[model samples]
Target: MYETEDIAVVILNWNGQDLLEIFLPSVLKYSGDAKIYVADNASTDKSVDFVRSYFPSVHVIQNSENGGYAKGYNDALQKVTEPLLCLLNSDIEVTNNWLNPIIDVFNADENTAIIQPKILDYKQKTHFEYAGAAGGFIDKYGYPYCRGRIFNAIEEDNSQYNDIKDIFWASGACLFIRNSVFKKLKGFDVSYFAHMEEIDLCWRAFNSNYTTKYVGTSTVYHIGGATLKNSSPKKTYLNFRNSLFTLVKNTDSNLFIRTIIRMLLDGIAGIRFVLQFKPQHFVAILKAHGSLYLNLGRLIKERKLLPNRSNYYNTNSIVWSYFIKKRRKF
Candidate 1:
């Protein structure tokens, strides 16, 4: 059993009344003694009122405006004083006793700053989810992938990745982290607005000599792309732009060369998107590169202020491996 009243499970919401209605019950039912909170992002709907009336036991904090995911959490977490912070997504459904396993791991390891449970798809329970399947890892060029997922290929759950292990990054979909560490990092980079902010936070933690782990004993079902549909061009824009921001801010001394190569590779990806009759995605890549170019000087100054971590990537080039060698399975 885990310690009572030490965990604060904070869900960041933004106009997701239906999602909160359907999924919040499982979280309340299985979360046990951990305090649950709904941090609304200035949603115009009656979501806050609904929570106040039906689930008054759950705490509610309203932000002044919709600051997306990164800033929304940064603003709300200031009011929470729990030792352990679980940054849960509003679209996820928790299983029975899911928090105990993660809490046990945290209690066992003093160096573990962040932990992510096994995330499976809510639609297809047999397959791993795309946001974060088992755990997260990055390649030489700063591309993120998971243990049970690589690009578009997702592995089935046969208990192959049941053993807990140190991972490069953890998914933000259902992440557990020490409250101290979250404050130390000053939360996520608000400039990121939405995507890849979690990976950036995990990379910073690694540089600070902290460990991120995957606890396979615990699990949750996530409705991937519920907030921003995967097919939306705006989603593509945010992902591409934010990934470039993460690379520039966190990459070591070889930032110039790496950024150049990454942009070239991105060009090739844009061509591939065009070949697939997705010109909107192609334009998204171009816009991402343009934004990166415009923010180059500012990002360089930001890099100078941080401690460099050269040992960031697990593989040299996940792009080459997946595309050329056809190494789809991880």
Candidate 2:
């Protein structure tokens, strides 16, 4: 077991006053010895003042303008001095003993750089929330799938993924990472303003030879879509755009080719959106690819600095093992 006193919990709040009221109390009650920091992204609702007034001990950082999600946390993380840092969304509530298990995993294994808790919905207790359902996995095609989420499919938690295991990525909704390792990786890539930024960070950890894990013993409740409001046009754009950038920035040549092939297949899936008159989905896909091509020169320069450039894994192997034979219900 880990000592809880060494952990610092950091939350980024936009215009979520209602969520802040519900979320802060549970965090204060359950997080033993964890200092709380609320980074307000220029919320017009007076969220910073509210937090400061109600929770005097909590540190509140008020930005001048609305910085996107990744940048908001990046700013707050700079001030965190604890051994472990918990990056949580404002729309989450922790249950009993939620913090210790994740801290224990980090304490137990020095190699474990990032750890995430099992997250459930606040109202529907048995259902897995959309943000990060029981940790995330990536297929060889660079497509990311969560234990309870496949593409657009989100399943109920059902205690099916309660066992602890190494994961490809942890949800930014409630991710825990060692401060030292976070510093080593330099935190989230700012190019990705919000969506898929965590995946990019985790991919970097994988390439850096560190492990990311899902610790099932810890549990929290999430009011999913608080930030993006599911399927919003801007959200869809960021998800597609950043995922494409993540593939380009991180993948080695062999996997890069495979990822491109799979992306082409996934792009074909967008044809149905066009046929059905869902112009936003089609536009999101095209814009993502278009942005990538537009920045091809910059991406090439970024790819050159990756440390393990030659250790690319096979996309076919990932597809057959994780997506096909496993039939793991995403």
Candidate 3:
């Protein structure tokens, strides 16, 4: 029961006409007084016009070019003046009092900067979506894992993760944060474009002494990868490239070195795909590394801005825990 009508819900749309039609109606139904903004990323499919025609009350910003995920949301965020800001995907459908609990969590804690809701797959209902499940966590080497997803293992959302806990990062799919904190952090890094930009932002928040939490009370159903399915080459490229970029920008020198070693080992894991003549995996890896090399100067410049100068996790500990020892998936 936040008295102030201060939440701004920002959804980024790019060729998501079908999802917009289904998701927007439910959002407007459940979200009481939150202002809504749909940022269209230059979709040739006329998604902008469709949203305007159907949802006249929703503010629509039509971009001339596809600015990717982070940039598209950044564009919309600029217009947001509300104290609370929610960066939701256009593919999400809300049920119950989904927005209120998140607002309550932030209201309860003055230091809490960002919070995420429990996310389930819209069609499956029981299973967690690949985008985010309970909440996201980070390994010692800066690799991100979540309660419901571990290296692509999406679990059933069985209310097992109902307890609230501090998290390393919240999924960008349905994230909420204080507008002032968002502005201080300067929003999402445009260099990331998409994929892992939220994790990078969370890492910065942690460095700046702000806490992020997972509020299981609030929930939403997500149509995972409506924008970035595995079959799409461009999506594959962004995931790989941005994952690497986030690691480089956030981790200190020692952790960065360990990440490089872990990446080499991970590359070996894809050898089977290469052997099976699956060229996309190899192409994704090649393009990712190639892009990193080309953007070395930019990455270095970004790295200098991180608050901490020394690696927090010990190298030997990470190697013994994550590397060297392999556990079987039962």
What's the TM-score of every candidate structure? Answer: 0.98, 0.92, 0.91
Residue-level lDDT of model 2, residues 22-84, one tens digit each, is: 889999999978888898888989787788888998888776667688888888788789888
Position 95, candidate 1: lDDT: 98
* RMSD versus native structure for model 2: 2.5
* Model 1 C-alpha lDDT per residue in residues 1-330, reported as the tens digit of each score: 248479999999988899999999999999899999999999999999999999989999999999999999999999999999999999999999898888899889899999999999999988889998999999878899999999999999989888799998999899899999999999999988998999999998998899999999998999999989988878888888989998999988898898889888889999998999999999998999889889989988888887878989989989999999998788
lDDT of 3 at 127: 85
Q: Give the alpha-carbon lDDT of every model.
A: 0.92, 0.81, 0.79
The CA lDDT at 283 in model 3 is 82
**How many times do residue backbones clash in model 1?**
0
Q: Give stretches of model 2 more than 4 Å off.
A: 309-330
- Tell me which of candidates 1 and 3 scores higher on TM-score: 1
Report the error of model 2 at residue 27, Å. 0.7
**Which regions in candidate 3 have their CA more than 4 angstroms from the true location?**
1-4, 309-330
Which pairs clash in model 3?
A: none
